[model samples]
Target: MFGDIMGMMGKLKETQQKIEETKKRLDFVLIDEQSSDGLLKVTLTANRTVKSIEIDDSLLDDKEQLEDYLVLVINKAIQKASDVNEAELGAVAKDGMPNIPGMDLFK
Candidate 1:
C-alpha cells in the first residue's frame, strides 16, 4: 500500500517536471493570425505572449477600424495558442498519470 503511494508520488513529481518543460517549450511555438482582408496580422507564442503586430497603412487612418481589427486578430491568435498549450500539457499530464482503480482521467 505504502509502496504504491510512493510510486504514485514519484510519478506525480515527474509529471510536474514534464509540464514545466512543456511550458518552456511552448514559449517558442509561434501562432500567427491575420484579418480576413489581410490588413492586420498578429503573432503570438503558445504561451500566449504577443510577439508582433502588423497593420496596413490604411488601417492607421481609421482608429476604430484598427481597434476592431486588432481585437479580432489578437483574439484569434490567443485562441490558437490556448489550444496548442492545452493539447501539449494535457498529453503530458495524461501520459504521466498513474493508473488508479477507478480514475479514468484521460478519457
Candidate 2:
C-alpha cells in the first residue's frame, strides 16, 4: 500500500512539473485581432500581455472614432487571448487529472 501511494505521489509531481512547463510555453502564445475595417489591430499574449497596437493612418483625422476602435480592438484581442489560454490550461488539467468526475468542465 505504501509503495502504491509513493508511486502515485511521484506521478502527481511529474504532472505538476509538466503543468509548469506548459504555462511557460503559454507566454509565447500570441493572439492577434483586428478591426473589421482594418483600421486597428492588436497583438496580445496568452498571459494577457499586450504586445503591440497598430492603427491605420486613415483614422488619424477622427480622434473620437479612433479611440473607440482602439478600445474595441483591444478588448477583442484580450478575449481571444483569454480563450486560447483557457483552452491550453484545460488541456493541461485534463492530462494531469484524468478520469475525474466533472473533469470535462475544464473544456
Candidate 3:
C-alpha cells in the first residue's frame, strides 16, 4: 500500500511538471481564430489576447452596409478567438477536460 501511494505521488508530480512546461509554451504560440464570413480577421495569442484585426478591402465599396457586416464579423471573430483559447488551455489539462452537458467535444 505504501509503495502504491508513492507511485501515485510520483505520477502526480510528473503531470504537474508537464502542465507547467506546456503553459510556458503557450506564451510563444499564436492561435488564429477567424469568422466564417471571411470579411474580417482577428489574430489572438494562445492566451486569448487580441493582437490585431484586419478588414477586407471589399468592405470599402459599401460604407453604410459594410459597417453592420463588419460588426458581425468582429463579433464572430472574437467568439472564435475565445473558443480557441479555451481549447488550447484544455489541451494542457486534457485528462480533466470536462464534457459539456449534451454537447460534443469532438466535432
| lDDT value, residue 11 of candidate 2 | 72
List model 1 lDDT by residue over 24-55, tens digit each: 99999999999999999999999999999999
Looking at candidate 1, the ten consecutive residues that score lowest on lDDT are 98-107
Q: What TM-score does candidate 1 get on C-alpha atoms?
A: 0.97
Per-prediction TM-score, please? 0.97, 0.81, 0.52
Residue-level error in angstroms, candidate 1, position 1 = 1.6
Residue pairs with backbone atoms closer than 3 Å in model 2 (clashes): none
Report lDDT per candidate.
Answer: 0.97, 0.83, 0.64
Error of 2 at 30 (Å): 1.7
Cα lDDT of model 3 by residue, 1-107, tens digit: 68776776776676677677766666566655445777767666555566777778887898986777657655665666567656665666555333435646544
How do the residues 1-107 of candidate 2 rate in per-residue lDDT, one tens digit apiece? 68776776777687788878878898898889999989898898898899998989999999999999998999988888889887887777667763445546545
Which candidate, 1 or 2, has the higher TM-score? Answer: 1
lDDT computed for candidate 2: 0.83
Task: Arrange candidates by lDDT, descending.
Answer: 1, 2, 3
lDDT of 1: 0.97
Total residue pair clashes for candidate 2: 0
What TM-score, to 2 decimals, does candidate 3 have? Answer: 0.52
Query: Runs in model 1 with CA error above 4 Å?
Result: none
